[model samples]
Target chain A: MSAIGDGRSMPTGAGLFDLPPELAIDTDVARRVIAEFVRGQLRQAGFERAIVGLSGGIDSALVAYLVAEAIGAERLLCLMLPYRTSASSSRTDAETVVERLGCAGELVEISPMVDAYFGRPDTGLVGAAGPEGLTASAVRRGNVMARIRMTVLYDRSVTWGGLVVGTSNKTEALIGYTTIFGDAASALNPIGDLYKSQVRQVAAAIGVPETIIRKAPSADLWPGQTDETEAGFSYPELDRLLFWLVDRRRSVEELEAKGFAPGLVQWALKAIAGSEFKRQVAPIAKLGPRTAGVDYLYPRRRPGSART
Target chain B: MQPLRIALAQTAPRLGLLDENLASHHALIGQARAGGAGLVVFPELGLTGYLLQDLAAEVAMRLDDPRLLELAAATASDGPAGLSAIVSFVEESADHRLFIAVALLEDGRVRHVQRKLFLPTYGLFDERRFFAAGDLLRATPSRLGVGVGLTVCEDFWHLGVPQLLALDGAQLLVNVSSSPGRDLAALNEIGLGTATSWRMLLRTYAQLTTSFVVFVNRVGVDESISFWGGSEVIGPNGEAVFSAPLYDEGLYFVDVDLGDVRRERIALPLLRDERLELAVRELNRIVSERAGQADDSTSEPGAEPGLDVAAR
Candidate 1:
């Protein structure tokens, strides 16, 4: 039976209350459910081909596998982008993912190109002025690399008539671990809603490589840098706190009741509240009577129109 | 021919609160259904909320996310005369990119999804930072016999997407938007008719294309940004059929006859007289000139304008 039919057949009237008696935490079932939904969306959007940037990381690996399962390997293109700071093993991990997924892929080394532009003594050292100079420098450098990669992706998208797919998960997105207009760009994303922990569950169900799945999440922007280390909190703790505060809409006191550290809850709330600007359209002055994001409002579509 | 009843949901979304926003949508959908609305439309990015900058990538969901599925099931169960609505959200792509997306749900399943094709990079609209622009511009086939062209906020402002959809035989044009209020004071100071200019643009498109136009916008405040919700419906003659209140979240319903669109187009005959071949030739000439200009001004190599085809 088709996945849509499978979804439709699953009793809906029960709402969230009617959990099956033996509701096992089946990540595979969830993956299939998510994949089916994404696939249906692509079909609805009239897109058959999908292009993805394959970083040697769990998030990208999981997204690639899901896309393969959803739309098939034949319709997916995995672009492996390795930068100067990238580990040799990163390439191998990416290759293994493409092989396992049986998808077509191309390796693009961004070192020579990145070095030529930013490695120059004059331009490269602008952001690298202090003791923690390299961190800032690497960020600027990473932005260039990310934009370059997107340029390539868009070029390929035009050539192949495919949509560029995104791989960012919920955890990284919460703390602004992504570069604006760089790694954060795509025509659609499938894993953005899943937290890091949730992504691992989905990855394991899809048989993603353990090397990627188990490794500490990092942007691979600079040497010896890890995401959790940079964020100052691990994904498990962060995800748990975020789920409660953002998803559950619980207050600081409610979080304390749930046994979360007061400081941690405060920290999470502050961080989320602080980063609120990153979540919206650019602010505009009210010039007209009806402006988008300002005074214009509508639901998506109304019901019962002419159907062909 | 029966008049097509339409409702617009013009409201701002609370960031990252999926369940709460979904609940709000459900209530609106229920109201639209009960009011005998054949179709309802919401503002852009209504699901996750607009101004979700990077959060769009994080909270973006697949069309089948349980929340969406729940919505679909509700629509299906509420059926055959039940309300169908177009809901917008950020959708994650296979490569981990996000798209400003709109999905049409009828009988509890998504009928079609259209991604925003134009990513405005200037001013405060840094859509290029998050969403990858869409390529296809064809009208999606809806259950309602007529082809419906779905364009998000920015896409309708451009001629390319709307024109392409019209050429492809879209009988109705629906633009879902999350446009934030900007520089109204500047317009007043400068004595510029920005609001009237905007109305003229919408009216011209409706009249020229000889298609019914439905523009839905979001309202409410997110941080310092306030959305001006001016949801409106225009007939084939470029007349305002129905308009919702500004700066508020409310439902505005209108009835339209598809036959009028055909009759208007027949009367106008602009669509029939469009100079497709000459337009392509002019575009090529402009591109060639731009390429020559780029080579001449090689010092400013970064000034190359992105190639954009005007669809409408």
Candidate 2:
């Protein structure tokens, strides 16, 4: 829908440069791979079902389809965790996926959880609760909403008997475009390897609604907030750059040689480097010879005989 | 040279479910045939599934087992011309020892059986404990004007497997694997996930060997392991022509020209420059020589005692 500004074309290199068409992943192969990943991650974690925080964005919608396909629709729980500021269309779009897939769906307004910390003045829980008690910045409030949504998803995981499936794509994950423990916290992520552009491709191949795919990419943190406009980078352009820079391991000079603008390349590389910590497990000191997450490397399905 | 139509079947095999998996092979072989593929490559232990600790013996199939004949028969019907398949399974050797093996089935019978040379034993892989390692390495010739070299999952990870296959005149290298997707979503230094690294390796092999590499990995979770099915067909130039998705199961097809192998070999003569004889001679010397007792008497002048020429 909203393609953002005139400069948006600069990043995508739509007219100036060509996105390597060959790098566009074969979607049929991607679907089967993701479906198996979902099923495998769940089975390893001893879960037959999955719970996804459906934001009605393309990423979540694609993940929902993959999780449903991996197990069955009946085994999936789609939670529309919306804040008061979340758009009505967000709820409707999420509901559409639930209805189409015939999976269980529930809507839990996150206003109470968020407002409990920032909504009240007497609830002196955090610093910088302004004169009226709410955090002044939209960014700060957005982070709270994200964290609350994750809390609800994990809490639901107990009763729903499913792993929390992540929806963040490779583009966002690389750019540190996701909330640290919020949308990033999941038992298994099937779409994390796919770039945002590839996410749209695989989403279309898997039959996600066109409306969801074409809509302006956003985290819906505040009214009128969109990802592209705020980040000053278009996903298509960013995905292309990331594919070459990260996946292809191309240097900034090589990217420039490939016709990418120098400024955009620097910005993307810095974003990727800065966010590198988010993509890894928290470092654990190896006090012992075989510390967990160190030499004590075991698969998610270890003690395999116990499951039987 | 004729272009080879190859199919990589990235399927999830249920553990020890030989009957069901064989039927699955039958269906997939038909699918590949219908898609005009001359050869269909399935994942490692595709018939028995991975993480088969005790179950490996239960599903161990003999080379002459009737189930294999049925699979060979699936390629019998009218479909693609010169259709053949390399399917992986646990083999019950004549001596009753189990081996992880790939069967080259064509013309309604078993053509050749290539067992896994390296049985991985580290981290999530207990293959060595359950199965015997194979010592032989060779390639099978196809009627479609291409020599097909077959290797089980871990075989390709070890050095020299690709070189050995190429030396034996293999233009196409097919690696069948049931490699579980560990750290499925975790990114490595360059931002590639663990599963994606597998594709990168296939690309490197294809490029270095000047051969078409068909890497078919299984999809689905077995016990606590989830096999990341990113089956791919890498061109001789190391470019990925087709790659199946991360954890899904299906038959993916790619048309690889055997002529490209020749062209690439001519263009980048890595294989042509290979010193196979030198390597063979050195390996023969190393394996045959026994470790001599420490002798300081024949030591070189001004040399350390352990570094003596007599020790060498």
Candidate 3:
């Protein structure tokens, strides 16, 4: 948790519970900015191609389209890694995006990796099958599936000759709704700054399929699982609170004054504070004067040579 | 002259988006006005993002454009009292040529427009292909009762523009730029970077001309370049009084003492002791007599060929 000068864990910027109309960005500006970011980040690393894990969700669909626009469809590779329990429509939707954008894509089955670890019932693991040996909890199976999918993506990265582009939006990132080292692993991200609501808006502007934008967001971890259903807070409400609390750095009292429910404010504050670790680099004890990532730092590029 | 409150709106402009960028300018102007600034400055091409290779014509606007007028009217008495702003944008002249220019607005109207004299075409800059060079150089009368000289990016690098403006009774020199940041490692210990050479140049100009220097630069990555937003205000004594954080957007308010302009000039006497007539006559002689021979490596080109160039 951040010990923000006032001992509160929040970022800077302010907003009310009701999403402000001004918060809606000009889509043209967003498209140009994101496209430029993708191109610039790749060019700096001396690469022109990017790979994305397409989940058939709004976030991944938007990212796939943006990357395709940045470095043409020939350079972008969209990989659909679906577990056995994943919905058939999700797979179909992912294929639809690939067809729409005309980008190269492949389906990698993640069922083997997930089932190999969790199929056994008597492991006594946290999310292992119960005494009846029926099934593992949804969280455990989801974590395994996420890690396996990332592993497959990274392995493909070698042959694909591209960096892994991130698909997590600001809302998921702030609430720590992503699996670390799994969906969160990426060489660079273009939409990390945009909130989920803003992501939907930009998706429409950038021609992400109407079906993808209209559907409810889900991690596809288990059957019938959706983000809003599990979280109990709608994205619009959460995004508005985050815009005020994180972006504007409003105090708890200020949020309450702006008509945010006390319980929701506390819950969001806790989530944001608890997830602070995922946002930064792992800390290293500074035994030496010039510790790495501390006093000793260099830019990604230098005069004599490029980084890669 | 009185002490003037100045605000430097260090902002990132979206490339080739005129309407959206103007909206950003308006928002920043409101913030500056709320901060009690009498004058606010924006970065170069603040109204039409930088790196506009071919889009310059698409977004080029005239001084009297209705959108600019709308921005000007923001400083009305309904907000802050007597607020004035200097914002940069691509300008389409009467003849349809485009020039990178800055507009000075006050009392709900554009009071002056200073076009960039030097169009940098080296390294990451390719301004010459898209923008025509401006020939005029002078200062405008600010509502704060001081002559505020305006420049855009490379114009200040020549050393002659600010000097000429100071000689023309300018008390403050403002340069709006879209300088990209490099050598970022050195910026922490010493405020120096690839683009920060302009900062040292401004400091020297402030020391020599005894005028307040205001520089506002944009931040954010564009294509492959990242503009460093180390917008700053230098006192007439060449010391920085206020500087915004690099790589971030902020509207920083600073109080500039115009009295320093008079105080430093009296102490240094650089402008007062200048041999204006001799310098002018010698420049004209060099231009007329040595026009061709100058590039041909003549032994004695100018009327005062043996004279030390710096002494003038």
Q: Best candidate per DockQ, number?
A: 2
The TM-score between candidate 1 and the true structure equals 0.47
In candidate 2, what are the lDDT values of residues B1-312, reduced to their tens digit?
667788888888876668888888888888888888888888898887777666677788888888877787776646447678889888898999999999888877788899899988986677777789998999888665778899988888887899789889998898988886543221132122566678778989999988998888887777545677778888999998887776656788888777888889999999889998899875655444323334445457665544445333
For each candidate, the DockQ is: 0.01, 0.11, 0.04
Count clashing pairs, candidate 1: 97
Model 3 CA deviation exceeding 4 Å by range: A1-20, A120-136, A301-308, B1-312
Give the per-residue lDDT of model 1 (tens digit) for B77-142. Answer: 443686678999888777777888888887778888888889888866667866788766778777
Question: How big is the positional error of residue A91 in model 2, measured in Å on the Cα after superposition?
Answer: 1.9
Sort the predicted structures by lDDT, highest score first: 3, 2, 1
True lDDT of residue A151, candidate 3: 90
Residue range B1-312, candidate 3, lDDT tens digits = 577899998887766768888888888888888788899999999888787766678889877788888988876666347898999999898899999999898888888899999998876677887789999998989787899999988888897899999999888899999987543221123333444576678789999888999999987666556676788899999998887876667788898778988889889999999999999986876675445434323433342443323232
Model 2, span A178-257: residue lDDT tens: 88898888878888888887777667668898889888889898778899999998877888888878767798788999
**Residue A3 error, candidate 3, Å:** 43
Ranking by DockQ: 2, 3, 1
Question: DockQ for model 2?
Answer: 0.11
Chain A TM-score values for every predicted structure, listed in order: 0.80, 0.88, 0.87
True lDDT of residue A91, candidate 1: 86
| Local lDDT at B216 for model 2 | 88
